[model samples]
Target: MDRAELVELLTPDGLTLLDSVGETDAVTDVVKAVSRLRAEGHAPSLVAAVLTQVKLRRKAVAKFGDFASRMLFTEAGLEQATRLRVAALHAGRFTAAELSSVADLGCGIGGDAMAMAAMDLAVTAVDADEVTATVASYNLAPFPSAEVRHARAEDVDTREFDALYFDPARRTAGHSNTTRLTKPEDYSPSLDVVFDRAATQPVGVKLGPGFDRSLIPENCEAQWVSVNGQVVELGLWFGALARPGVSRSALVLDGEGTHELTAPQDSDDVDVRPLGEYLYEPDGAVIRARLIGDVARGLDAGMLSPGIAYLTGDRDVTSPFVTTFRVLERLPLDERTLKRELAKRKIGALEVKKRGADIDPAVFRKKMALRGSESATLFLTRVDGKHAALLCERVR
Candidate 1:
């Protein structure tokens, strides 16, 4: 990975070093060679292939704590990496038929571009960072129609693209210590700017799952995608790529099941009822999509509180959009008595779920120390500003 080694790897003479070696060993040697080249200030493209080769080896990637020391990703960016990749793949699925040519703006490491190219789409990937663009070029080399360009999204020519994909930088000028998007406007190229430009062509913009729902544009269709019950990315689609009457959708996907529920745009007052024998708490994405009412109607359930997201019904309902739980009992949130009762019932392990309760479940669990009992779900919440616990089982 030193200067001479990097030069050899990039030159015609060094090309032979990459040949006649096993594929696995070649990848390792390439990474080592590229790391040395980078240390020596060699051209970015010279190390692109090696970096991408490392990325492809999932086990070789740095762990969360080690990422800052080794990789270039910010802590917040790393936290959302898996979710972003899943969202990008899911969002791409929605527009697979119409996407012939795509422009991946801000193509970090070219993960999305690689996925799109795998789907047989011609992609022109662009990134402002020279190193990132070089990495993208090497990552996308397997696809015939894929090309990497060094440029900003606004400066790139959009005429040749059938669709545009954007993942904006969410950091601020003075805040290097924090990785989360501090302000809504921090979204790179800004959501408004991306949308305005995308109005000229099909566009897909990725946002954090935690983004405020009120900020979603009216013209675009917003989708909240969850993989294996974990809420991932939020996506906005514009132009011809948009779906009709589907302003928002909550997608819950698992190996054996997939559920998609769309929210109604028209707001109407719905009645709230008691937490019946069966209660459903939709995923965070479903709540963000404003699809609670739709879910209630579909499941023949009623709201527990006028503005709350909880839905209740008299009978067990099967739905992938939400987790259905049967209420076993409701009790006070007294640590001592609750522990006693749990022990009496032989419930050992607890899965704590909280809403509107200030108590820390971890501390509470430690204090209880009911190790001999079976597993149980403990729901902590404030009912009329009073804390309570509900023992329940997943209705599924």
Candidate 2:
């Protein structure tokens, strides 16, 4: 949002209108609300701003849960904000290390700051964008010990705080439609400077889960976090915040609960084996953390193929780190043969999962011309160095 729109939305009347509007996600509801608000003599700018926030708040619910209703968000800020559960874990690390104060540099919309402050730690949250900083201040208003500053992260003196948290801006400057800055040097406050500061004090930096593993500092703990099967962020912790004897970690948050797999370094891959009665798909965080081998060993499983993430074993073991599927039968790999087999089984609804295969699932599904009501998961992958289609059912 622009400065004028923000100015209009921050007033008592505008916020009251926003609250009154509640949530109008439907296009029809939004249009009707706009007409009614304008008819009631509300300013066009205020109406637009209020509705925009209502939509953003709805989208923010996935990340912030109930707290999103009371929060203000920029489109980009909300998109980049950490999940509340993950943020709480970040806060817990500092508290566990006995750090009472934190300098949250490049803190977009105060997500991490809110979590830290809620844990009763003093927080100095800084962001380069004025609108985002203002929104962060509003989100952090409930925490008396938390302060928001609109300034470049480099300008802050980090030595004053007991610990430091860096969430460098990875997108272009804007409230919306910002391009991702892929190069580490393109990040705001820059990785070089952030790592330099980490050398002397306790520091934690949050980056995308796909961050270059080679660049990870040797002295820090690299943790990849996934929520509900999706790998979200890779966090690097240095000094006191870094867990002892752990360098690589995968943190999985799912319906079961939180589970973590840690190793001194990347684990060695298991030898490839023939397909078993059941197949396992490791969670993305586990794969990204390079702990798939550890998980495979735990399940008494072997790789379906070298360098592929899928695992297979005859045991009926299960773990939160992997989704298990029972092999129903083997299907032909050729499109014509696969289509004929699918027709014979009368299989219609399907979930296509693949590893070490080049075919597009959508196109393949379309060609199958499915007409039956049977549902199954088709795993198109390499088994014993040959392309195979494993018709399976989810075991968990």
Candidate 3:
């Protein structure tokens, strides 16, 4: 949006209109709301903007909860903003270190800045884009300790702050339709520059979960965090901000609560064993953290294959770090043999899962000819490096 449009949206009257049309659920409701406002003498542009913001705020409830109602979000900024729950954990690192001030370089809509400020810390939140900085300012308006600046992150004087936080923009060029830029050097402010600052000052760098392992600095602590079931982001902590004696960690947050498995280095690998009565799929955070071996050892299980993340055991041991499945029957990899085997068991509805395999579930399911009285979880994976299928039931 242009500067004037944004300025208009922030005006008392426009915000009142947005607040009045709070949390629209359907297109019909939005249309009705917008029509009512337009009849009340509001401009079409103002009505359109307010209706859009209300929809975004409602969708944002998943990430920001009730705070989303008051906060403003740009499309790209909202997509990249850290979830409030995870931001609180990031803030805890600074809080534990007794750091009172932070510079959130490349801050998107001030999610992290809001969390830090709530914890009684001073934050200088900076973004290179003018529109983004304004949106961040609106979101952080209640936090007087936080300041938003529109400037290149590299130009910001880092020495003035107690700590630095970087969540560099990783989108590929075009603003209209964007793709993820994979190379670290392609990142704005460059990974090299971020690492350089980390050497002299405390730094926390947020990166993609699948970031190249070779580039991870020797002195930094690498952490993979998973919310619910999905792996979200990889966080690198350096110097005083780094957790003591913890070089690699996997943090899992689900309905139960937060649980972590940490190691000073990559955990020892386990030997491959024959398929057992049960199968376990490790959480994405565990796989990304390269701590699959640690989880396997904890459950007294062995790997199904040398490189596969799937584990097998004769016992039904359960851990918060791994999802368990009970193996019902092993079927031939060939489609005909699998169909015959499944038909005998009267399997119907299917939940296809795969890892270390090339087969597509959608295409494979078409061949199953599902028409039975029962439902089952079908495992499409390799057994000792050979294609195999296991009909199973979810333990949960």
Candidate 4:
């Protein structure tokens, strides 16, 4: 939102109108609401601003749950905000370490600060973007112990806080339609400066899950977190916040609750073996943390192919770290042969999964022209260093 829209939305009438408009996402409803509000004599800008926030609040439900209704957001800020479930874990780290205060650098919409403050920890959240800082201030207003500042992260005096949390801006400066910044150097507040702070104090830095692993500092604990099988963030913890003897870890938060796989360093890949009755696709966080070997060991599985992420075994055992599939049969990698085989089985519904293969599932599915009620998962991957196809049924 621009300054004018922000100004309009901050007024009593603007807030009341936003609440009255309620949460809506359908384009038709948005149009009807816009027309009605405009017909009621509200300014066009205020109407637009309120509707935009209405949409954001609807989308924010996945991250903030019911708290999303009480929060304000920019498109970019909401996109980057940590899920409250994950943010609570981040807060737990500081609390576990007995840290009483935190400095949340680049605090987009105060997601982390709110989590910290909810735990009764004093928080100073800062954002360089004026509008985001203002929005964060509003989101954090309920917590008297949490303060929001419109200032550069480098300008903050970290000595006053017992711990520091850096969420450097990973996208180009904007409230919407911003491009992701790939290079660490391009990140706001300078990753180099953030690292320098880590050297002297307890710090946690949240970065993209795919951040270059080689650049991770040797002294910190690197953790990849996934929520409901989606790898979300890679958190680097330093000093007291860093767990001893744990250089790499994968945290999985799914319906079964939280599970973690950790090691002093990346685990070695299990040796490739013949394809077995069951196939396991390691969780993205586990694969990203290079701890698939640990999971394979637990399941008594082996790599399907060298350097491939797929694992296979004869055991019925499985863990939250991997999705297990019961292999049905092997099929030829060719499209014509597989199409004929699928038709024979009367399999219409399909889930196509691939690893170490070059094939678009959508195009392949269209070619099959499937017509039946049966369903199955087709894995296009390698086994023992050769292209192969494995027809399987999900093992829940």
For model 4, the stretches where C-alpha displacement exceeds 4 angstroms are 24-28
Q: Taking the tens digit of each residue's C-alpha lDDT, what string does model 2 give over 1-396?
A: 998999889999988988888574323388888888999999999988888888889899999999999999999999999999999999999999999999999999999999999999999999999999999999999999999999999999888999999999998999999998999999998999999999999999999999988899899999999999999999999999999999999999987789999999999999998789999999999999999999999999999988889999998877989999999988768899988888888899889988889999999899989989888899998887888899998888
Among all windows of ten consecutive residues in candidate 4, which has the lowest summed lDDT? 22-31
Which parts of model 2 are misplaced by more than 4 Å?
A: 24-28
Note the residue pairs that clash in candidate 3. Answer: none
Go through the candidates in order and give the C-alpha RMSD of each one to the true structure: 6.4, 1.2, 1.7, 1.2
Please identify which of the two predictions, 1 or 3, would achieve the higher lDDT against the true structure.
3
On a 0 to 1 TM-score scale, where does candidate 3 land against the true structure? 0.95
197-303 per-residue lDDT for model 3 (tens digits): 99899999999898999999999999999999999999999988998899999999898998999999999779899999999999999998899999998888999
Query: lDDT per residue, candidate 1, 210-300, as tens digits?
Result: 8877778788888888877777778888877677787888888776666777754733424677667877887777787777777788788
CA error at residue 17 for candidate 2, angstroms: 0.9
Error of 3 at 361 (Å): 1.6
Model 2 earns a TM-score of 0.98
lDDT of 4 by residue, 1-396 (tens): 987789899999999988888555324487788888999999999999989898889899999999999899999999999999999999999999999999999999999999999999999999999999999999999999999999999999999999999999999999999999999999998899999999899999999999999899999999999999899999999999999999999999998799999999999998998999999999999999999999998888999999999999998775899999999998779899999999999999999999888999899889989989999999998888899999999996
- Model 1 misplaced stretches (Cα beyond 4 Å): 1-56, 59-99, 172-178, 266-270, 383-386
| TM-scores, all models, native as reference | 0.77, 0.98, 0.95, 0.98
Model 1 scores a TM of 0.77
* lDDT (Cα atoms) of all candidates against the true structure: 0.67, 0.93, 0.88, 0.94
lDDT order, best first, reads 4, 2, 3, 1
- Write down the lDDT that model 2 would get: 0.93
